[model samples]
Target: MSGTAHKADVRSGGQPGSVAVISSHVARGAVGNRAAVFAIETLGHPVIAVPTVLLPWHPGHGPATRIVHDNRQFAGFMADLAHGPFAGEIDAVLSGYLGDADQAAAIAASVAALRSVRPDLVYACDPVIGDESGLYVSGQVARAIAGTLVPVADLATPNRFELAWLSGRVLEDNEAIIDAARALGPPAVLVTSAFAAQPGMTGNLLVLRETAHLAEHAAFDRAPNGTGDLTAALFLAHLVNGRGHLEALRRATASVHDVLANTRARGADELTLAADAALLSEPVSDIDVRSVGRRSEDITIGG
Candidate 1:
């Protein structure tokens, strides 16, 4: 389904709190905006979705057409939203994959503009640069996000590889993840794919101002894309709903775990978010959350 089809199907109840989701849009799969928008809205938050690019499906599944908006037009579109009358309605902004490096500056500008009116706005930046396979995007695009967006983000959700790349170190353990997260400059950093204590589990290590937590769940084989996107959106949504940091982390992790398990059970190629929508609100997945204590001074900078 294209964004058009999604827009037609999703009908919010005119909710008060709305989230601005800026990412890619896939016609047939739930990857970027498709994943974030539905996850946010299902939790009762209205979504203002801005697509950085449009795709028929994720490139991982097969070759698909890519539709990137012209740089000037993209900037104008984002500017209109930022300066528009309803800009203040946005409670939070979650930015993901970018089509071009210039898009990072445009997003930063929009975030800044929104912050001027709503000083307490929560901006979560998901630097979707690459995974374990190394840098997937151009070095320029990665640098643009690191320079223009990451510094301003209230929260950053980066997988282990991304965190390692951003911090200029190899993160081999949770402690290293914590140290790098602290040095990364974001007030709060959610490091996904952190080392799991359990043999068959993976974790999301959340390092905040004064505390660190690890939320672990069973590791599924071949999990679909957009887990990070869904996790970031849900975590922010929970915070906006007044949940404490620990609660938000646990809930968000559980929701993603449940959704992934469901998707796998059905043998679906993409996340079955629509079928597992209820899990977003009432996730039944058992997430083991533990306090990992405060940051440690003994940090190892991996080679």
Candidate 2:
């Protein structure tokens, strides 16, 4: 088993919100893990990471990352810690890409246990299933997340594809996506990789009980692998910090868009932390928090 710990100075006196991230740990590089750490740290939150497997690099259609020692044992290690130190301290649990359905079930069961201890603990589950093409998680895992985890989640961030899978809804436009989100029964649903009726534009949608707001940045020519992870991390952090779903969505959307912009400006394949981190604390520069509607007079894709 191999791992590395990089610590940052978290602000003192702020509410010490605790978050448990159940996702994979790639020893060398993973934008998702890094984004999760950065987002949580910015929010002055402590995090316990439960990894699926310790790998050298994140295996996907992205940049090559180095692999150190394998820490496949870390998953159980995290689970054990969850039973102990991660008891009442956990204010929120954020889950990302799981290796398989069994892992999803295990995560769901663990979440249930945590909830047993702290009934108010928020579970922000990002059902990392398939994307525009098809399903990525095992069928059993997909089913477990949709059936078990989602119904109990306080907040969920599912990409457009995952939303369709979880709700059995065909999201052709913004209206359909919002309806699908409502069907899932979560108070809030952050849908990434959202495509509107437009021919070639992709963005994110934040659907709440009363409002459905769409935040569209010009779709980057390339797809960044850990984007959803980053979005989920910040959104959860904001929500845990007392920001409502719509506010959190605006902030998260702006933060991710700024990160992508910085990444492109630097000609980097991955996010540019130096420039992007500045936006972490203040995700959206302008927004009317009172109203849950787009302020920029942008065209609604599917209403």
Best by lDDT: 1
Per-model TM values vs. the true structure:
0.92, 0.80
lDDT of each: 0.86, 0.69
Please state the error at residue 52 of candidate 2 in Å.
1.3
lDDT of 2 by residue, 70-95 (tens): 33344365457558864777877888
Pick out the ten consecutive residues of candidate 2 with the lowest summed lDDT: 1-10
